[model samples]
Target: MSVKPESASELFSGPFALGTFSAASGPAFPGLIDREGQVLDLRTALSDPALTMRGLLERWSAVLPQLRELASSSEPVRRPLEELRVLAPVEPRQIFQSGANYRQHVIDLHVAHRAPDDDRPEEERRAEAAEIMDRRAAEDLPYVFIGLPSSVTGPYDDVTLPAWAAKPDWELELVAVIGRPAHQVSVEEALEYVAGYTIANDLTDRATVFRRDMPQIGTDWLRSKNAPGFTPLGPWIVPAESIGDTGDLQLTLKLNGEVMQDESTKDMIFDVARMVAYASQTARLLPGDLVLTGSPAGNGMHWGRLLRDGDVMDASITGLGAQRTRCLAEES
Candidate 1:
């Protein structure tokens, strides 16, 4: 099925999606799309002339309602979704990722890699981690790390495995795209900064996570996770208003058609509001910035399997859409 624009008068009859895509001719552009996969040219329809996902995010407060209204009307330039190449929803200026935020995921890892000397049942260890998670949720701040924007790639692009990486892993997450500037915002008002939500596959090089030489400094996320195309993001961004109960959405990932990571956002030790607010306290969050709200349990680390050449990943979240990434080893 392919989209061919018939007339400007035939806009989508109802609700639609939005994101960045490369049309028949041009660089990466942003536009609105319907469930039927019809694209509404945002530049032509909104009379912006120059609009990207980044631009829409920058003027989200003013553009959202306008987009909604235009989508409902019948006088917008239209095209089929098949006419374009989808890119990452937004090229983020700052990428913030939450770590160890899913209680069961952390517990599962601990149970799988138990120490030889410490003899304890899985149940006891799980309970201990659960207790710590609950207290940490209520008391401690989220553990966040900065990611490189260059690591991001289109949802359907190829994931290049670095020659130096022995173990590549996937962490599927719900990514929030920031709309407005935020600095030291309270948790109550943090959600207001989000323009929309998208899916992100936070690909990591597991073998590089720790440094034997510099154990005190801990994980070197930059070397482990910032390879080109490491972050596969979005088929599209669903407006925040359309998403109901962010905490309850299911996050799932499949490697070569096998369900590996499947869990609900409810398992998050720290929710989106807290994650965003905590991030703002340290640095100013600008439009198009991304915040990945941690992955749920069942990653490759817990399953004892890492990604290899030719492995395909299909990851999805409720309503936000899915992404498929094919992995290939770097050529010599």
Candidate 2:
């Protein structure tokens, strides 16, 4: 029960979790996350021009019949997931990222368990202990960091940067896809509010996450975390209906098939429902908006753990599928 955040599957279970996603060659479309980091085609179910952001939305399977009808009658050549390029499942007008969501991640990385009553001697130890609970809960909160629309990349893509950069690394993460539009919801209503799940690596710069424990860390989190190719998502977008509970799967990140980080979603202090519920209070979550759950501390950005050019990084979160990317040095 005392395992690190990398091993708990309390948050990644579900039907979509068992598959991959794919779409037309030119543009990105929603589908399922498969076993080997590829997208399973959802066909015409997601291509409906008449699709409404607001509808019955009762079950993910309700649309299957319609999808079959469209696929069989296809007059144009259908695209194969393997042949086309992949992209982030959600296309939210804006993006949001989370910070500080796992317990062992805090201690293992020396992230000071900052709290309100450190000044009160009695509360100092208690505050630190609370991090254990808060760590799991924080994954659901995501802390809301913004990103550039142009910076997103697909599964198996390259995570690259200019040689002049200070630091660059990868954080294996689970990305939550919103099913419908929502504002001001409750934890009790969170799971029902989701569309599906995807995988993401929240790469960060060492100079960014560990600076003193104040406002500066926040500044670096967004900058170092959002550079071009920092967010490698996709491969699939299994509908929430297909994926049962997302909190019960195995997640593993390996460098050349040798495990570096391994865990399950169950360790997430904050579960899925609370995350969507908490976010709706301040911001609007649209159908294509992406909520990148936080990463465990095993990322390469910690001190001696930085990434190097040519290093292969493989990230897989339970049912959402795995992503393989190579670190490349930008050309001069």
Clashes of each: 1, 50
**Which stretches of candidate 1 lie above 4 Å from their native place?**
1-14, 112-124
Q: Cα miss at 291, model 2 (Å)?
A: 1.0
lDDT of 2: 0.59
Candidate 1 clashes: the total is: 1
- Give a tens-digit lDDT track for model 1, residues 52-156: 788888999998888888778766667777667777888899999998899888788667656568698879988887887888877867999999999999888
Candidate 2 residue lDDT tens string, 171-203: 787777776677998877877667677788777
Query: Which candidate wins on TM-score?
Result: 1
What TM-scores do the predictions have?
0.92, 0.72
lDDT of predicted model 1: 0.84
In candidate 2, stretches whose alpha carbon ends up further than 4 angstroms from where it belongs are 1-80, 111-142, 210-218, 301-303
The window of 10 residues in a row where model 1 has the poorest summed lDDT is: 1-10
